[model samples]
Target: MASSSTNLNAQSKFDVFLSFRGEDTRTGFTSHVVEALRRKQIQFFIDDEELQRGEEISPALLNAIETSDISIIIFSKNYASSTWCLDELVRILDCKKRNGQIVVPVFYKVDPSDVRKQMGSFGEAFVHHERNFPGEVRVQKWRDSLIQASNISGFHDSRSFRNDAELVEKIAEDISKKLEDLADPPNFDGYVGFNSQIERIKSLLCLELDDVRIVGIWGMGGIGKTAIAEAVFHQISSREYSNHFDGKCFMRNVREESRKMGALYVRDEAISRVLGESNLKIGTLTINSYIWKRLRRSKVLIVLDDVDDNFIQELESLVGQLNLYGPGSRIIITTRNRGVLGVNSIVYKVKGLEHDKACELFCRKALSRKNRSDDLLELSKKVACYADGNPLALEVLGSSLRQKSKEQWYNKLHDLTLISEPRIYKVLKISYDELSPKHRKIFLDIACFFKGEQVDNVTRIQDKPTSLRYELEFLADKSLITISYKRLQMHDLLQEMGQTIVREESEEPGKRSRLWDHEDVYDVLTKNKVRINLFDIIFLSIHP
Candidate 1:
């Protein structure tokens, strides 16, 4: 179960727990209500809250209900007759008054007059209980409580028959708003969705039709490309469907684990961890067989982060070793090259943050001094503009600007804007400094000429690029380099950083080139120029 703090900290979200009599109407009204909530994207908890014969509500369930933002009580005809239902109602109403738990009552098929007046079937049940018990005042008191509960001003009077989407929709809307108020706060928590540039990848990934769709997300260093893939991974991992896997595995970097840890090491470790073994050792072939057998029985969510595009064949071998997976089973690869993912699959090219989101993110980091003056706000936006929404650049500037005044902000912005040169490479190098030589070369080539390029391109570029690819991928994966879809397109900020590393590595400055620029005019004249860009480029060509 996810914590309330996580849902609350996330922007504009809420959780609702529905309290309903399962046997009476779970398949009918309750199912429709739950479906409606889902269609509206309202998160809710509506599992059977009933206790089994000799079971009582556990501490976990009670706590979960208490922590939830709102509770909906479905008051059907025989609701008050059941002691269990009555107890749940009492608890819900108590929480409503004390802890601000919102409780909405829906009188299903039962008249409000009969409930409040206690004159019809409601009165007979209480009367029989009184006569049969004779001396139990508790039964009489429960009857009075039920009558009082029905008289509450917010109780819905009408029956929720079939074909009431409009009415149900209105009630759901009201509940949704209350839940939002309780769940959302004035400011944002650190957790955010993938950057906009990475979102482009998600949009494209949704379009593929393969039974085994694979996407590789790739980018340069410190560009937040890996963060994007991780965000999506976390998102999908939490869904109920993810439980189909024996267990999801996150392989940090392919090379180190494959080399140092080894396939046997991973299989043994994963099985031990899942099955709770202190120390277990099996032969490599046996371990491999066990892993494949386990995978065949379960749908797995595997993330291979930071891979060498050149090791495409090695990747094929790994996936080939496994048995067939279920429909939703996914394997995500993050590399520095796009071509490694194959042309038949979807390819997502991650870029940098848009100007606005980058500005907001930077302000949160830079303007740590709570209160910002109007003058500072203007200056901060200017500084963010200079960063160009590149996460690396934003962090660099923001970290530098912490506790600084408006004048300092202007000074930094002016210095950055005065130069025509981009700062992505400079920002990325800070993260690259920590990588090994194998990873450094991988990062550089990917940043410059290899981004969105195929696995063959790396081998074509260098004689031993494939051998180095595995090691490079391992480094990038561990360091959280971006890899998704089949190819690699580093965030702009990371590309800039990679370019900076290339410049520093080379003895001569003139040797480095920007691949995106048009340096060869005659080649463009001879060729059609292809007009390759992001989605907008494709859209413009179609519209033009």
Candidate 2:
């Protein structure tokens, strides 16, 4: 029953460090556990004879325990008999205390009560150790390590599990679950205003609910909808529901994935991920049945980010496939379009950062140090105002102005007023360009002439009630424009970008599709001739 030395280097680096007595379970129970770990593709380190013969645990074994995120201590009949195994136990416990390493004790063919109390074989082993090395403090330390490790809630093979095979499977399953949790950490560095939003969303999640709760986060682009969702998802996965949920997955940029590989592909991938399977090729025709059957008893937390109308439809179909889910399951969707959310779902509208928050965000992005010169602070506040609380605009403008001189800041601010900054404009134009031709025309008209006009007046001007209504809905759904208090409302930067797009069409105002400038209007009127077709014209006569 002696264990042979195997000096194989860890293939993907060790994730789980195995500590056990080789002569007792190395050939039987421990071997089964190693095979299970291999099938699960879990990296583990188990020492052989070459490592076990030293006066103390080798540096390689100690280093492995220190580096590992998790340690599995297999306590068999004679596990505590060997001084080497006891040394490993002490080192593993040390790692658990200092490095936050997870320690899982599997009582193989041994009772946890016996291990904790140092009774039966464990007591006999301690007596033999004391006699062999009298007055040694190491024996007491080994006993303490065993008691501490055994007290932790872990798999008890003799009491619960039927056999070694079943025990191995359960151990592998627990390891996989813990590994999934350790994979993703919350990333909140330089992330501003995320906590309040996450708190609101968490309130809406109501994790106490047994039934599936779907929460929607809707807002315009660059408003931090996805960022908020990601932060919340990380919190839920790693903290709140880490041990409770059966599985979790965060599918990011769903719109991009849908465009790259259809909505059904995204749906399949999400289901596969939450189900802990990879390359699961379920056809769209039968995916629903497959998902429902697989997830029926499982509690999961899923986050679908950057969803759009098309992807939402696919998501609906995917959810429809699931017949039932375990209680306490939650799904969070982040989308720019409110209409994409289910009517019954609670929707949180993410708005631009408040003035103070916007200023803080801009300053953080613009200045390297916390202490700022008065002039730079003034310039930052002015830029924040120009950004109008848009997170992306603040970031882009702040980064562009970082380390620039005060005069350069003034020059940049002036340039921003005249034309939209390219980076900010490019992002704003995405929502604009997604509009249909009719919707695009309506958005342009609102941006150009009717931004603050009454909605009724704008509708009358357009003179197409049915088309205008539909286009307005489309524009609103796309987060390009808003109808508020019976008036058309649009983001200032969006309006500027729309105007810039029109200006780009023709350098001469007379040759453009729309004319709003005073000099251009005067020139066209004074010429007493129309050179080109004009979509609309506005003229304001001055009172002398």
Candidate 3:
């Protein structure tokens, strides 16, 4: 019943801290490593929430790593690039010296020499930073930290590490042995909400991180993008390898603002803080570049949550730059926009719950009822139809109706139509505005007459409506509405929302158009005997 975070905070024996480049391992090996730890019942934390303050690690982050029993550093190519990762590496080494905290290394794609001496691209990047901040103590510290981490034991070469699965088994076995050695183990009960979905995502991350392939999960807003990323992170961060890294996790939430001082910008500061450096030249390094550099040789999982469509481009240059820390280094990105999908990232479209699942969810919130009632079931179906399987809408409406009775449900149900308002209207209008004028006209016509009316009958009432079928098909493709067996059913609430917008847009007298039906017009039309008289009389609803 307690939240995982609550349980983790209450514990004194949190197990492992996972450190790595999310991009390199998110879709591949890291997932496998994390799953292995989870299977063995390890407690850990892996953060993908973007840092949001200025260029310093918050006190809370420092405490999380300090509290962990061990740190796992998955060294990939870009590990050295992130100052945050460098600082975490320093913390782990400090813990090693100060408290004998355990440290494990998975030598992803980079060599020990590279980490030890800062050779290859890392050396060049550091040298460039040293030059930029000439004679800076922080630069010297960064160099020293890299050397110290490279010298640690428990190294695994990803290039020569044949059979990723077998390697993962060995790693898991080693972690289990380490757990056996620990005097105290943390209590971990796992995460809440959609366990199977989390497991599936973790599997994908493991395979992707192991193979050093990129993977992305894309979907609509609040479709659990960040949640899935967080789930995969917890799965891996609890492993034995995580102890080798400095901190439990580094999270970056990108939704706040991509501008200066945003989450990504703040993560840079967090890196400096975590590294225990004062006034480090953090900004000279790109955030993603810094993340990659620090995670190069360490087994770590980094999460880039709520990324924008442009996140793919920002990471393209750094993908090949990471050390490929075998299967333990991973990055998971959560976004509502689908454009973030890339070749390195496997893109999964997260859909809303199916009807039955959504109905169950609705009942739990709406009626304080989980059991399906023969009578309530039909009303629930009608409400679900109005929601159109959107979990947020269903939950909101259900919560609103939780204490209401059957009569209240009936009144609301009667008002509910092929069209809806508040939520679906604005969303549909955005989609509708993108259409051509002819398409817009057809959409508006359907909202007015053809909504509940038989499509064929409505079409017959309008001259040349047959010519609009192509536009209608286009709208259907975009999921604006559904047409089936010549019976057109609007996405219930969306139709109402669109009708409301149309009504507002026609409020200007010069427009001389009406979207809603008024009783006065029906009465006038009924009283009129001739078509000219009908025209003279403005039946506001019928628009004759």
Candidate 4:
């Protein structure tokens, strides 16, 4: 299950929020709907009578409406008559506009047109309120809220169903089904060559057993450890199994976060997310027994991605090892070093894509052309095999050769002879540093300025059209770039490296080789920054 803090810190407290006039349907239709939703095991919020007594919406009710993933408004004939219900509708629509909350307006025993146009009972209610309320603006706002809510496509109780029981059941089931999207499961579709590893990892997890298990997945950088863990997490935690773990957390890029922040913060964040709580003040000096008791009682699934030897001990030192979690709990730790998890830990080693699988994966990314000639297919197979089945290398090199001519393919293959299969993490940087001075200049220009420009337009803008193509050819040969769909495309790593190089060229933006950031360009043009460096910028192009 996804925690409340999954997306943008939006803490979702309830799956559904029910808004209705208590006096009209509290004992009849709303009761049946609540019972049906309970039978489906859906969490919802239905306002009590105390909430309806106030002229303004209560803070608790407002919070409930704000935190709910979906709002179901029972628009009975007398729904608009209650000022409290009108306020709730306005807030519900406001939430829908602010964050993508789902709103279902059920028109019960009322004409849709009447609610939309503020006619019939809706209009009568508004007229009476407009006269009774001191301020006319509030009443008008309610009228506008009704028109907007009624315009949305939702359940029509009278026309869509035979009776109230059937309609209530349908509503509960539909809402329950819609809540599945909130889980945001990792998608394996369109991904090739991952089934064998995913299945093996699942079998190692041993979720069927009653004992707790700690599985460590270790591989070289860029070997698909994170992808495999994510797929396994989605498969086991999915709603298909009723016995899924009570709590689950996937902490991504733990190494990166530890470098940027501190290890203590990262450890605290992992614990809070796994327990589905916020503001966990678990100090290192004094650990609470209550926290340990709760951890020992609840089943948890945690993925500590990219951790080191010291960090594992840092966590176990506080949580009391496997004894902290309940039986049947599973913790998956991914790292580049297998020794980090200590000797008795169950470990899985991930190898790169095999021969045939590597070729198939490479062809999927590289060759989109339907009419593939024999020579092109042969060259592609040779290049993929040259990558030694390393997924990162194959993808980087394959993408570089996409949508190019036969002669260009031969030249790219020849360039591969100049370099061996380098390590995956430094592949982009090593390729860029090896380029000729002119090639590097052209590459940076495209990276900083014309990323998505047409080939013809870029050449036309350059000083020498013929020489520009030569530089582009070498860059593509090094697998730093690829042209596809009539557009020049460079990898994201290349762009970041180029920008960093230019940034370090000089402190002053105007004196730098390129200007991509808008604020820097504006300051250069408007503020007249004095260039203190003796060197002049070789090329200047604003980011397009």
Candidate 5:
């Protein structure tokens, strides 16, 4: 993807659109703002066409307004006098409402109240227009546009600035900061250790195939599932053979964003990106039916990143029956829970990086350079080994250990033996935190006591509920537990993380949720300790 691709919005062709009375500020304040924008490499457009009497706003000008991310309207005394400027104002306001375009109004020696009410100089202009063209069809629309634009919060040119240059600098700097915050995609410049995984997924994608395929990248949290999907998405966007799709959209952080901003927001986000429409509100129409009709005509490649099991039903409505999608359309979903995709969907399970690649990645992050110090080389390898090839763990630990003394590195590695690092634990905990209470108990039980136990034996425990198998399968679906050869298994880090969580619940074993160590279990049971309110009865494994 291009460097500017990160700044993509609904129809963002220009960063700034300058709409003003050319006669008022073109040579002075407007030119300075444009110069400042040019210095900062801010893309912008300004119309220079001379307006003839009763002429309409140029299509080129309207398109520029719609495409621009931000519009700066300079409200001057004579700004309302020209029908041309009024027409541009009306279009800019329309874009603001329709495309979510940002609008900045510069009250250049004109009162905002006057602009809103069309008073004083504004009144004079309207009076002249009324006398010239009685009962003008668009006169009320121009007044409404002025009112709407004036109501928005923007810079007021008054005693607030030292001079016009200061004002121009302030406005330009403010807009630069805004553009920086608008939709910068995840940075992968220093991203490492996932090239092969990306390649494997791409081969599975089989871009040459003409069928509409759904591919699921399934893995535990922080295993680089989203990273791999993002790489494939960008490749399909730019690659020669795969670039035949009519539209492309990468809907990132689907799980997190849907939780943060309602599911409707995510649904609409996917629609506008894949459909290439601006600020499309699905409420006005039968949206699923509308999508069903619109998607059948054009092939589109879309990635729903970091999806959860709960979001799959919404995904069905969003894409609307996979076969109905236009030919060659490919949909990729990244998830921690494979069951969310069902038994039939093609799933690629993502594993950790190999040891050598893991070491290389850790060294790069820890040293902040490609080269490594001879003294730290062995220590780096040791730290990487502790990370167990998990990319997120390596990144968090490596960056945290950057520039630390050799003794500190040893202490850090020693700390890893006893507990999961808090930062790494926080990320891996999200999957656990999202689980149902019953499933969470099942997960902790496996982590603490039942890991590697035969599935039938664990399920046959006298006190265990009949739903144990259901909960086990649920945990397996979430990748928190594994079923292999009739035995349950779990990742070393996740197991340790669960134990750490239990320990933190209370210092006393009797009060904690689960007891793993033999001495702790014996002490609690033999002492006849009363269980805490949180757990009515202390649960422990009855394995021989």
Candidate 6:
């Protein structure tokens, strides 16, 4: 039972917030529930007279309700009589609506239908309130709150449960299961060749150190940096850190959020999430102060995913300005560019999956089963080889060939080999060509100027008529481009393809729409080329 509770990995200030009528069930049913929660070592908050004596729910009690991951509302005979209990109910319901708090109504000797319809004792309590409070809006609100809460599926005394002790154990078990589910790390279902990388990164993290550690996971796009980081983060979060940190873990797609909102918004959200402070608003002046003040002494695990070169400066500035985090804090950053990581930061370069792992992944994707099919094994190996251990390519190719006949598979494999460019590029082009013109433009822009650039910065660069957010999401869904850490990310192969497309627009370099080659730009400029049809040109000058 103790092991069961520990296994839940539920990240919340309180495991459960017990809402009940003290006079009715405090020493009886509620007391038994409290003892069960205590034996399990679950963190819970049950308001006592000291906290509930005021006319209104105390700020402390309200905070507790908001922070708790789950609320167990005991619907007893006299539950509605206490205005304080009714107020707490309203707050719990509000938290459920706004914060995704889980509410469980335990009908202890009260009928579920009576509670929902406000009949019998529930009706009597409301009637008394109507007479004493005299048609106040507060009474009506409580009634509505009760009706809504009762509709939610929870423990019912008469129908679903009978014995009180048995019910208490069931509730504890159910809560434990919910916590376990919440604490369960991101499913790497069908994930392959990631355990070794996770171990390597974990060793680099050096969790034993008391100092803040910022480790960088760097690789080309589609190399599984994000996946690897996610696995490691969740493993650390659910296993080792749960006991020490009490659920203080924050993982954000920094590129995605930074692009969709802004860098500041991402910064604000990170602080808010780690500190368990929701809807936390901070300006440029106060954001840094707030972050440092809140996080300076707190040990936390933070993962900033999909960082890029363009956003690196902003991140650096933010880190410096905020002076983020206390000692023992660990920040994991996943980026395509190695330059994005600071000099002192430990960097782990994510590599492609091994041949065997790649083959297994391919077979799983293409055959819809992990076990190698005798008929498709040879073709699967060929496809895996073409994928070059790239998980994304394997997935795309495998999915493309799924449920196809052997003859069709052979024809597709032959066609795949005939492509002059890299196999991965050819495979990615399918997704690229599927995009609308607007989405295509967005993908091309990201491949060129906006890759790893913040969303706000990318929006500033585009002269488009419509919002690129939708187009960006479309590209991401198609796997042509990815939005991580709020920045646009493209695989090296896709980037190459985009560049190749621009180059193929015209035979002469000067006639191309975009020119990144320094020699071509120099020839276009210094030689005064006649057909300079370029819309964008990047010139790089190196000093030796």
> What C-alpha lDDT values do all the predictions have?
0.57, 0.74, 0.59, 0.73, 0.74, 0.72
How accurate locally is residue 510 in candidate 2, as Cα lDDT from 0 to 100?
70
Clashes of 5: 0
Writing each residue's lDDT as its tens digit, candidate 3 over 1-544 gives 0001213243333577777777678567777777666655566666554545346655666666778777888888877777777777777788888988888888777888888888986887787777677987878888897777777777657666677887776776676568657743321211223466667776676643344545577776534565566656655565443333232233444543343234434455334433323333445335455554554545445566666654444544334334544344555666666666565676766666677776777677666445456887789887776666665456545654566778877766665652546354443344465568877777776665465445666666557777656666666655555674356655434555656667576454223343235443454346652233332243232332
Candidate 1 per-residue lDDT, tens place, 1-544, comes to: 1212212222222367676677776887767667656544456666553435333544445555676677777766666556556556666666777887777777777787777777666677667767766887657556665665676655465545345566566667677556545542322222222445445655555523335456777665445655667766655555332233334556555533454345555545444433323335654443355545655666556777666644455566445443455444566777766666665445665666666677777777677656577777778787777655566566656655677666766666666665576665543344465467766666776765555545554455566766866764654443324443334545554665666656555443333432223333223335655343353233223222
Full ranking by TM-score: 4, 2, 6, 5, 1, 3
**Distance from true location, Cα of 258 in model 4, Å:** 0.9
Clash counts for the predictions, in order: 24, 1, 90, 0, 0, 13
lDDT of 4 by residue, 320-372 (tens): 36777889888888888877775546899988888788887777667875947
Model 6 Cα lDDT, one tens digit per residue, 1-544: 1211211122325768889998898889888888767654567877664442657765666777887889999999999888888999999999999989999999988888898898999899888899999969998899999899889988876346657888998887678567766653565743688889999998898878777788899987677887888788767766435424422544455665565567777766666566655446674634555456667768777788877655665567545422367677788888877887886588888889999999888777678656457868987888688778888887767766667788878877777777766556776666466457866776676665566566766666557625667667656645567675466776655777888888779998777766656667778888787555344542123200
Better of 2 and 6 by lDDT: 2
The residue pairs in collision within model 4 are: none
C-alpha lDDT of candidate 5 relative to the true structure: 0.74
- Residue 66 CA displacement from its true place in model 4, Å: 14
Off by over 4 Å in 6: 1-78, 81-185, 239-243, 246-252, 285-290, 318-324, 370-372, 420-423, 430-544
Please list the residue runs of candidate 1 whose C-alpha ends up more than 4 Å from where it truly belongs after superposition: 1-14, 47-51, 128-148, 151-155, 159-170, 180-364, 367-392, 400-420, 428-544
Q: What is the C-alpha RMSD of each candidate to the true structure, in Å?
A: 18.6, 18.0, 21.3, 12.1, 18.3, 13.0
